[model samples]
Every structure is written in C-alpha cells, then in structure tokens.
Target: MEHQWVLLFQDAASVREILSHLIYLSFVLKDSPPLFVKLNVAIILEVLRYAQMHQLFPTFSLQTIVFFSLELVRVTTYEEALGQAINLQKSKLFCSRNTLDDLKNLIATTLGVRQVLGTCKYLGLPSMIGHSKHATFKFVKDRIWNKINSWSSRCLSQAGREVLIKSVLQSIPSYVMSIFLLPGSIINEIEKMLNFFWWGHNSANSRGLHWLSWERLSVPKVFGGMGVKGLKAFNMAMVGKHAWKLVSSLESLITRLLKAKYFPRSDYFGASIGHNPSYVWRSIWSAKDVIRRGFQWSIGTGEHIPVWDHPWISNVARILPSTHHHLEWPSITISDLLITPEKQWNMELINTFFDTVTARNIFNTRCFLW
Candidate 1:
C-alpha cells in the first residue's frame, strides 16, 4: 500500500506538470480551462486527499504533506504560481533595486519561468495587486465586447437579442460578480454592453436610444420592467448568500477559515471590519448590512438572541421602548420570557414590560422555543 501510494504521488506530480502546462497554454491563449482539464484536476485533488487520509507519508506530518500538496495544486491551477516558483528556483527575484553585477549575473542566468509583472489571469479571472477594480474587471469587459462583436445584431430579431442578453451575455460576469463586489463603473459598462446587444445597434460601435433606463429594465416582469436583474443588487445578493452560509454552514471550510480569522470571539453578523482585511473578506463584510436587513432569528435555545436588541418580533423595531431615562434593561435573553418549568412564554411578564399594542403583537407572533 505504501509503495502504491508512492507511485500515486509520482503520478500526481506528472499529472500536475501536465496540468501546469495546459494552464499556461490556456493563459497564453486568454481562455478558460477546458472541462476535461478541470475534471482531471478535481480527480487529482481527491486522490491527494485520500493519500493524506491514509497517511501515505508516515514519516512526515499530514500538515507538511498538505502544505506541499497545496503548493503543487496551486502551481497546476495558476500560471502565476508556476512562474513565481520557476523564478524563485532560478534566483530571478523582481525587486525595486539590485547590485549592478548581481543584475548582470541574474540576466545571464538561463530563463526557466515566465516572469509575470503587475497582473495575470488565474482560473479565468485577473489576479491583481491592490484594489484596482477597473483593471481587475477589464478582462470581463473585453470578453463581453468580444462576444458582442462576434454576433451580428442586425441579423437577430428583438426577441432573439433579448434571449441572448438575458441567457448568454448576463452570465459572462456572474462568476466574478459572485466573488467580488463589482465596481459601479464595471457594472455600468456591462449594462451598456447588454443594452447595445438588446437594442440592436446599427453597428458594433453604434448605439440606439435606450427605450427605458436600466434601473427600470432590471425590475421584475411582474413589476412592469424587462425582468433583467440589476447587477449591483445581484452582486450584493450573491455576497449575502456567502454571509448566510457563514452563519448556517458552520462546518464548511470557508466558514471555519472566516471564523478563525475574522470572528473568533463573535458571530458573523457581529464581526468587526478589522484592519487590513483581504478583498474577499471586505466584499463579504459589505453585504452584511443587506443580510441583517433581511435576517430574522429563528429562536433555538434563545441564548444568542437578545430580547431588546435582536429583531425577534416580526414587523417591529429591534429595540423595545424604554419606560424611563434611568431605566436600563439588562441583556435579556429570549429564554428569560419563557416559563422555565413548562418551557413556554411568560404571557404575564410579556404584558408587564411591553405596551398593550406591542404585547398584543408579541403574543400574535409565532416563535419556535427549541
């Protein structure tokens, strides 16, 4: 089994090398990885996981294997990693300054890797430095432009154009939008591309007068608009979905990473925007407000839910009204309102603290006590 595992690692390395080459070619060609290549890479990852689980390298810790295996996978997936690895191996480090002879010696050394400067495509998305939103989304814009330029608007009918815009053109940015809070400029550019495509402009460079504003067009068909999704809202909703997962999918890898890094002491909604957060974290954080706006607690043990602060009551303010200026409510849990022995809400206590209207509303509102 150990010998077979060794052979598997060797095979994985060869497969990784081939994948690295294919990834490089795809990057050079400015195209996404083929479906077959992605499937093979997934298989390699599963095999690596299995090998790790079985303690293939008994001499080394699983952490060590995982660290190196991850690097191998990174090199295979991203051309940038492969280039960086080759550069490191060749001692061709890119820095602000180097000694004259050192530079000469470095130049004289045989080039083993493609030295990527500034930004490069990684898994069909631009991997960039800093927060240059426009530059990062330039590839997406170019892709949309190329796709639009390929098709003739004059040939397609209005209905056909709408179908293509909704189904094909809008989907171009969906993957990127899901991860990044797209800049308004990029969103507008995408909308403009879609508009031009839908309206059937005289030529690729020309545009017909927009019949309705994109804001209006983005409304649901039932709401009297074109039923096209608003890009910004869609992006927010996608990020909010991640936030939902962070709360609900507690055992997920992403949830674990986020909890360790951002909200070690607190929950996801209460997490602070800590200093120097990653772009992904910042994007996720931006959608927290949206999540909070729509979120309502489904009472479990009620230990986590605060009666005064939390939005426990349906169609009511999160905080209850204070009786007097000096009257300070303690951090009251939802469990406090319940009769402990029977595990039921204390109706008399509820009526005592709240106003008649508020008390009536609270009684009417359904709550799960478990």
Candidate 2:
C-alpha cells in the first residue's frame, strides 16, 4: 500500500489526471487513512442530514447554517481518537429512525440550543455581512440600538463567535470560485447572490447583538462602510495562515525549528520530501489558489491605493526606473514613424494603430503614450 500510494502520482500527467478526478479521488481516499475515516463518515452523514433537512423543511432549514459548524469541528478536532466516537454516535442519534422530528431533536442536543432564531444561519445579519457571528453592525440610530450607552459594550460568548468565523471562512470559497467560473455577463449578475432575503440578529443587549440590521453595515468602505470584512475575505484570512508556509518557506534555522518542534517533516502531514509534500503542507498549498483569489489586496507604485476606475492596478512613479524600462524601452519602433505624425497624434487613430502594432508584434498590450 505504501509503495503503491507513493507511486500513484509521480508525474505531471498523473497530477493533472488526479486533479481532474479530485471529486472521485476524494471518495476513494476515505478508506486508506484509518484516522479520518470515522469522522469523515460523520461529515458525510451530517452533509446528508443537511441536504435532507433543506429538502424537507426549507422554512426551518437552519441546517446549512450549522453545517459549517460541523465542518469546523472536523478540521480542527486534530485527534480522531477524541472526536470519532462521540461524533459518530451523534450521527446515529440523528439518523436513529430518519424522521425529521428525530433529526431535529438530535440536532438540538448535539448542536446545543443556538438554533438561529431568524431564517437561515448564513442569512443572519452578522453572517450575511461576512462577519463572525460575534460581529453585530447596529444602526447608529434606532432607539433600541442607541439605547446602548457605551463602546465598552458587553459581547457574545467567544465560543459562538469563533464557530461563526470558522464556518464562514470554510464555506465562502466555493461560492466565490463558482461565480468567477461563469462566462460573460453571468459574472455581472453575481450580485443577485447578494440580494437580501432576510436579516436579523439576536436582540440581546450584548455587543454581538449590535449587528442586527443590514442598513448600518454591509457594503464596503468606499461605499460608505466601516469596511467590516466579508466571509470571503475572512476565509482567505484564515487560509492565509497556511499559505504563509509556501511563501515564507525557507531552509533555515527557524523553519527547521518549526519543523522539528511543532510540525516535523516526518510526523507533519505537509512536509515535502523529494517530490511528495506532507499533508499539512499540501493543504496549505491547495489553499493558496483560493487565497490568491480571496486576497485581492495588493500594493502598487506611488503609494496610490487604487480607485474603482483603476482598481485593477495603478502605476507607480518609480524613484528608480527599472533597467528594462529605462534601458530597453522599445525605443522608436519602425511603425512609430510609419504612421503619419498627424495620424499618430490623434488619440483614436493612435489607439487603432497601437492595437494593430501590439497584436502583430505579439506584445499583448501597447500602453506607450509619450
């Protein structure tokens, strides 16, 4: 088994083939690892529970809201020995007879009371805003909200907040990626995904309860917001911890120490040896692509934070002209003089000529406008 598993994905073609079969391969991989099998069974069972819950009781389907809660438990449980038996038992309790009432009762016990008073869990005010359940964006007005006297506000239980963050971080990527994968104007229509079906937060006069209404906070800072991050951003923020491994990786004293003490190459899941990396390392790497997409922030030249008009990128006023630009600035191309100076001088004419020249020369772009 070791030898076969080792040889399974030895080449580029194999990696591509495996990626193509990622969904199927995931199912196949459940058997080999003894540790995760029990809990994975739990996850599969919960996934089914939620799916059925959604189908049967759309009105009461807070199931997907808490689904992330289960996933959070799975990833962080660390030791199968601690989680498997209890969680597995929880599944049986849920499916004892496969009736909605029994499932609801089981969920009530296993999930412990916080059954989300409003519509769905994700649709909750804080959750909708991409905040941890702990976050509460209250109206600066509203007699009820205004009644709270101090910024030194009481907060929700830290436990609930953490679970909220974990759930949102894990679930948002699939939505963001699926949106980007669509073609043409379909991407533009992605705003429909943000349409509000409902919004409410706990009415308790606690700090966390402040995030009740959608009116006070949601959009973004530029759109006049406190710039409270969304789930998509938080998800990347969480995934970024792993991505730092690949980016900050080095063969140094610190890395060696980290490897030896906390995550050894041998014992650690993600450590790379020759070709194969450890599982911990691989998970971080897998998350990199998602992080890359989630982490859209970047620093550009001239310390200019780009506006929507130039949000894609902004040019920096270079203190030191890069060698390639100062030295090799494609000086005076033959076509530069081919077009009449009058023609070249016209912005419209120049744009057409530049496009043709760039396309013909295989430059992909021609932004030179001296």
Candidate 3:
C-alpha cells in the first residue's frame, strides 16, 4: 500500500478487517471496475505506508506492499526484500489444484473410521481445527469464478454429488454442535432440507408461474406430493430471518440469543452498526411487517389481514427499482416486493398462525396441516 502513510493517522482498523472489507466490496460490487484501479486504493496504500512509518504492524509482519501483493498477485519468496520468508505457494492451501477433491479425500480417507465425522469440513469438530479431516460442507459456489470453473466437464457427477450431500448432512450435526454458542444446529438442519429441496432441480425447473420461484412439493412418502421447497425460495426465506433480526431485533428471540452469546458487548438492535449486514438480517428488513408472501395464496387484493384487520391491498410489488429497494429492508408491505399480479400465487402458508403464535412446534406437531 503505497498510500499507507496518508491513511496511517487518518483511520484504519485491523488488517483482517481491511482485507475482509475489500473482498466483500469486490464481491458485492462485481459490476463495477476493479476496486484497486479506483483512487481509494492508492489513498489506502498511502495511508498504510504511513502506518508502517509509525510502526503500526510489526516490521517483520506483512508490509503494506506484501498485503496488496498477496491479494492481487502471487507473492514470491525469492524476493531479496523478503529476507527469509516461507515458500507460501507450495505450502499454502489455495495452491492445491484439487482443492475440493483433496479436501474431500483428506476428510473421507483420514477420518473414515474416526466414528465422529469426516475431513472435507471447515471448522466443526473440536478436534478438527488442524486435524485436516474436518467433515464440513465447503461453500463451493461462493465466488463467481469458482462457480463457473466448477461447472466445467471436470465437475463431479450426480452420484458423486449425492454422496457429497449425504456426507455433508451427516457431518452437519457434529460441526454445528462445535459451535454450541450459536444456533448452528438449526442452521445445519436448514442446510439438509435445502439439499432435499434442490435434489430434483431439473424436474421442477419450469414452474406454473415464474420458473425461479419453485412450486411447492410435499415431502414424498409422508405427504401426498413430493416434499421439496425450491432451493432459491428456501434460501430467500432462510435469509429473511436476518432482515428480521436487524429490523425486528426485539421481535426475534433467536437473534437476541445469538447477540447475547456472540456479541454481548455489541448492540443487539443498533441500526447504525454495520454498513452491510449478512443475508439473513438484510432479508428480514426487506420482508418487513408485511404478511408473508407464501401465506397469501394469491393476488387476493383487498383480502383483509385476519390478524391485524388491515385490509389486504395486493398489487405487483415493484421489488427491483430503487423505489422498491427501500421496500425490502425494514419491510413496509407485501406491495413493496417487485411483483406483478400474475407472478403472485395463491398459495397460503399462514392459515394456522394462531396455533403457533406464541409457542414453537405446538401448532404443527399433530394431525393438523397448514
């Protein structure tokens, strides 16, 4: 960072924070040009240089130039300026060509008879921190490049996918249990259900309505129809809780619990805390106070809200335009969604809200169906 000196005394946080922010920006702002080319990059470099002048990071640690280089290019150990650095390339995790396969093989082969879990996982088992055989479901579809690269002819087969999914599900509980403080169990359960939802993507790729919003499938064997929620829709629904955690902070007990445990010192419902929040929180704010879309069976405009007695005013929620973006976070109404009457379906999911209004699982445990 050539401009580190300029930003040194100005304002800066930890290196990880800076790196995370850059990566995040690069992700969300993919449509824009490379962030480094922008003036802010030079400015930050100058600031980092200033920090080095003031002994901000240890002289032996990653210098500003190295910091930029690591993220931007392959930093070679041969550089005389690096004194006697480790050969990061050969010794690093990202350097592996078969990252996924290598990780999976490491987990399945090494931890096969371990009894508890496997190795492909991330951070789950207490013994998995450096065990190299952690049975974790790596987010393979995270980056755009990775996602595209993964779809090539060399990608794993359907049978392999099935095995991977099953293994991932099996390891979920163990991994989640390790994160005892967080609601990892619920998150894990959700992930499995998501796999079930997407297991038959091709069969239901085309919907009676919009192809993206999956038509509900009753869980097969138990329910008359095959039970499958659309993965995309389920993801959105799961993400919705985050928005609620933020916009309706006091309204959600789980968010409060997480905040109490993970961030007791941090504000639970502070609106001014973060510039960008996780998908869950952001989705909550987007859904707002509006009745759940899944609850409204159709474009039943003027259908009264039975609970609040607020008249149902249905229209296509203009969800995309800037006019509708505000409608997402701190949800204003169902109308806030960028929708048309045609896209809105008449599938009701809130028929029995009264049954579980205050109690969890009390409404759906027995013979009743919503």
Q: How do all models score by TM-score? A: 0.67, 0.22, 0.23
10 residues in a row with least lDDT, candidate 2 = 190-199
lDDT of 1 by residue, 1-370 (tens): 2343344345444445534644554466544456325633564455445544554545443333433444444455565434533334533323333323332232233223334345665666555545687887777878888988889888999888878888988899889878888888988888877777777773546756888888888888898888987888988998888988997899999999999999999889889989888878888999887877777777766776777655777557554434332155666777777775776678998877887887776666666653
**Tens digits of per-residue lDDT for model 3, 1-370:** 3354334423545655564555555456552235343524444455455545656455333443334333332223233335665543323132234334433333233222222232333332232232221223233222212322233222556465444434543343333332221233344434434343335322223332322222333244274533343333344445544544543455478767656544455433233224544423333434443324332222223222121222232332322212222333433433322133444322232222222332222122221111
Candidate with maximal TM-score:
1
Error of 2 at 254 (Å): 27
TM-score of 2: 0.22
Model 1 residue runs over 4 Å out of place are: 1-115, 202-204, 315-327
The superposed Cα distance between candidate 3 and the true structure at residue 176, in angstroms, equals: 11
Per-residue error for 81 in candidate 2, Å, reads 13
Q: What tens digits encode model 2's per-residue C-alpha lDDT throughout 81-181?
A: 45534343222222323345644554565444443333232322222222221122221122223222221122534444334323532243334332122
Which residue runs does candidate 3 get wrong by more than 4 Å?
1-223, 246-281, 289-370
Ranking by lDDT: 1, 3, 2
TM-score computed on alpha carbons, candidate 1: 0.67
* lDDT for predicted candidate 1 compared with the true structure: 0.67
Please list the C-alpha lDDT of all candidates, in the order they appear. Answer: 0.67, 0.35, 0.36
- Those runs of model 2 whose alpha carbons end farther than 4 Å from true positions after fitting are 1-32, 37-101, 119-125, 128-139, 143-370
Shift in Å, residue 44, candidate 2: 9.0
Q: Is candidate 1 or candidate 2 better by lDDT?
A: 1
